[model samples]
Target: MPKYPAREPLVLLPCRLPASLVARFAERAREQGVTLSDVLRAHLTVDEAKPLGKAVPRKRAGLAKVSGADPKLLRQLVGMGNNLNQIAKLANIASKTAQPMAMVELLITLKGIEKSLEKLSES
Candidate 1:
């Protein structure tokens, strides 16, 4: 077998997910020719926030309605794409400290923050 970079140890988490969802993920993993662990690892390795899509011009009235959200917050959210990259790098480091669980929590918290920002932008 060809050698590859040594992967850091992972702690198998017992997630209380719906059986159907679990089975779906398992099937997807199989279709991708990877183990479930590989699928999760790929997810965990994402280091950047991706754009929702191409920005579309809004009507003046619609823009006014969305402007109710704080301008600074909107700017931060618009610019937060790079921030997620940094967070992922930190998560990679945190993986080595025997506190990957904490790192995962941090990643989830950041995702929630990003989602909330998107909600505001969509309004």
Candidate 2:
């Protein structure tokens, strides 16, 4: 009986490409004296350790400008937001360390913020 060496399993990756692109790839492979599969594999191979390039910024939809809004109310809302953020950070830290947070105070602050937003919208 003859024994054969084990071979790694191969997977079939079926892909559809335009005829023009396929022809270009074939021509490049012939020029380089390599198979079309080799050319495609070389192009598809990525270096896992290499960091990615900077991302391109996408155009975003512009927000509508709020006309005739009270500047003082906006400032107050901004201050409230800052306070809420601080409380949330503390609450998160406490929860992670198995400590209790002032849940009632947080709820009340949230409600106040909601009411302020409604008032701003009405004006």
Candidate 3:
């Protein structure tokens, strides 16, 4: 008996697709009892006249209009990262020196960092 099924070698074609279109393809595949890849292959294999499956509607404009990140927010993230590193160093030293108060201070600093992150995400 063969350990693996015989099949052609396949390559992955990664792509970004809209949620609605992906849902439609998934529904079609379910209805026909086939994988999404099978549905895509059928659609791609066309004759001279037309392709398989109904044509999807044209995508809307401004769908990929993403603005650049704010410089201020980037700086804030960097500062927060530095604060975390400092806290980690302090935590190690406090543990070695048996300082409970230093550990408490580190915990407070971590809470502040969490709050700052929450506020940043909200904006």
Candidate 4:
């Protein structure tokens, strides 16, 4: 992957969206409970990825809505990420002080994290 030399410049755009679109946009923006700019960036980024001639269909054609966001599962994912880091430390010790079987448990933990990530992506 090519690395960017600098952060992308931000420009404030003032524009209007359709009524139905505004509703969908508002719903997605609310899900993050963050700044409106963040949600707009996410949606518009998809547009940036597409070919210029192939615009997203109007009235739910190109619009993407957020769904199936499990807060509890999100928390679990965060905790699991932290747990994996801690396990790395233990695995370091285990490699010297304990048997190779100890690393198997770490691999299982990693697999579980991967599965959780996949589930989140699917949602």
Candidate 5:
């Protein structure tokens, strides 16, 4: 099986179309070396996939314009409040790992955190 970047799962979206047009659209997508989803996304409002060059400036300006800003850099700011809570839990686990039971617990905690980080980073 081919591997792809770990991304958000595919969401089923409903659309109205004649059967013939839908079949033709699918065929055209195959000929163009892309999936039907790719064709749909190209013509749809794909906000998340906007070019980073455009996104970065817009996000930065929007964030900076807030009266209370600057505690964190732009990249750090998105979804950051949740990140801090996760980091604190990790540190607490590490600090309590001197004894054997504590060490095992810490290992489990660390593993769970690793998986969570992998999911978030992929996003």
Candidate 6:
């Protein structure tokens, strides 16, 4: 049996399909060097057509103009950002290799936020 990602589950979603149709997709999967599951997941989008995977990075929006922004409010925003960063760092260290799925999701979310902050700082 092939091994999947350690963080992912071995989900078996069974459904009826004609043998010929399954063979067709299997052939395509072989030619494409990807699993039949990947092909089907990408092809089907009835529920919601969310993109399958990571998005192409976009150029940062650049910081919003703050020429007339309140000074105290701006300082508070910066402080909040610093606090969030510290929390993320602590979470990273506290969640070990065998962390639960929920913790992994939290880390992913924190990582995304960190990336957003990084792009914001670029401007």
Maximum-TM-score candidate: 3
Full candidate order by TM-score, most accurate first? 3, 4, 2, 1, 6, 5
TM-scores of the candidates are 0.31, 0.35, 0.44, 0.37, 0.27, 0.30
Worst 10 residues of 5 by lDDT: 52-61
Q: Scored by Cα lDDT, where does model 3 land?
A: 0.79
* Residue 121 displacement (Å), model 6: 82
Clashing pairs in 4: none
Residue range 62-101, candidate 6, lDDT tens digits: 3345356666657756876887878677677667555677
* TM-score of model 3 vs. true structure: 0.44
- Candidate lDDT values, in order: 0.72, 0.74, 0.79, 0.73, 0.67, 0.73
Q: Each prediction's Cα RMSD?
A: 16.2, 13.0, 11.8, 18.9, 14.2, 15.0
Worst 10 residues of 4 by lDDT: 60-69
| Model 3 residue-pair collision total | 0
Task: Report clashes for each candidate as comma-separated counts.
Answer: 0, 0, 0, 0, 0, 0
Off by more than 4 A, model 1: 1-74
Report the lDDT tens digits of candidate 5 across residue range 1-123.
234468957689987979897788799799899988777666565565566554443335455577456645555545554665775676677677645666566567667767766786787
Q: Per-residue alpha-carbon lDDT of model 1 for 79-112, expressed as tens digits?
A: 6766777777778778878786879787797988
Runs in model 4 lying further than 4 Å from the true structure:
1-74
The 10-residue segment of model 3 with minimum total lDDT is 60-69
Better of 2 and 3 by TM-score: 3
In candidate 4, what are the lDDT values of residues 1-123, reduced to their tens digit?
Answer: 223347776667899878898788788778878656666666665556766686676664221234455667656766887888898888898888877788898788878878878997897
Ten contiguous residues minimizing lDDT sum, candidate 1: 42-51
- Model 6, stretches more than 4 Å misplaced? 1-10, 47-123
